[model samples]
Target: MQKSPLTSTGEALLRGQLQTLKTSERQRLRHVLEEARAHGDLKENAEYHAAKEEQGLLEAKISYIESQLQSCTVIDTSKLNTDKAVFGAIVTLENIETEDKSTYQFVGEAETDMEQNKISYRSPVAQACIGQEVGDTVSVDTPSGQIEYEIMDIRYS
Candidate 1:
């Protein structure tokens, strides 16, 4: 599989989640399974069945996280350009119609948090902003309609 580019912070976050799931979550699930097993027969024990299902889900999540970590390439944002929008660049844009301003940090897929204004590079807005400099007007096609934005500033941290 192709490796995805991720900011150092995003990579660190993924690694941290993976570590927590592997150690704490795994341990907790193991204990839960043991407790459930001690309760009753395997055929009709609701607690044992639930714990086994939970264990399956937990293992799947750990596997998925490990796969993402294995296919990640960390990018250091400190040395990136602040003049143009790019991966790891925090872009501030003004909505042409509403005159509202919003800031978004372009990050990898694993770290895209709409609530926090962190968008993935593969998203429409970020794709439109890539290679665009400040003061440039870019349009992104959404499910509603095409929205236009003017780049106000680009920052790298």
Candidate 2:
């Protein structure tokens, strides 16, 4: 499988979620299933059916998270160069048409939170900004139209 790039923080968060599923959630679900099984008929027990369904979903989540952890490459942002926009760089941009400024931290898909100004590296804006330096203008095609942005600064933390 192709490796997915993830910031170290993103990797840690995923790992923590996996740990919780393996340790606490699995045990809790198992207990719930056992309790439901005790109070029922095999075919008509609503509690038993719900518990079984929940267990299936939980197991699937655990499997998915494990797969992601196995296939991810953790990137340490501090070691990256700050001279150009790259994965894990905090890039400041100015909208060329509207002159509005915005700052975004480029991260992996799992860590992207638009409300926090974190964007995935695969996003159109990040794709356009990657490998670009300050004063460089990048144009990205959007559903509405092509938008232009001027890179103002790049920093790594």
Please, what's the RMSD in Å of model 1? 1.1
- The TM-score, computed over Cα atoms with residue i paired to residue i, of candidate 1 is 0.95
After superposing candidate 1, which stretches have Cα over 4 Å from the reference?
none
Worst 10 residues of 1 by lDDT: 78-87
In the order shown, the candidates' Cα RMSDs to the true structure are 1.1, 1.6
Prediction 2 TM-score vs. true: 0.90
Which residue pairs come into collision in candidate 2? none
Q: What is the alpha-carbon lDDT for the whole of candidate 1?
A: 0.92
Whole-model lDDT, model 2: 0.92
In model 2, the runs with Cα more than 4 Å from the true position are none
* lDDT (tens digit, per residue) of candidate 1 on 30-63: 9988998888788989988998898899899989
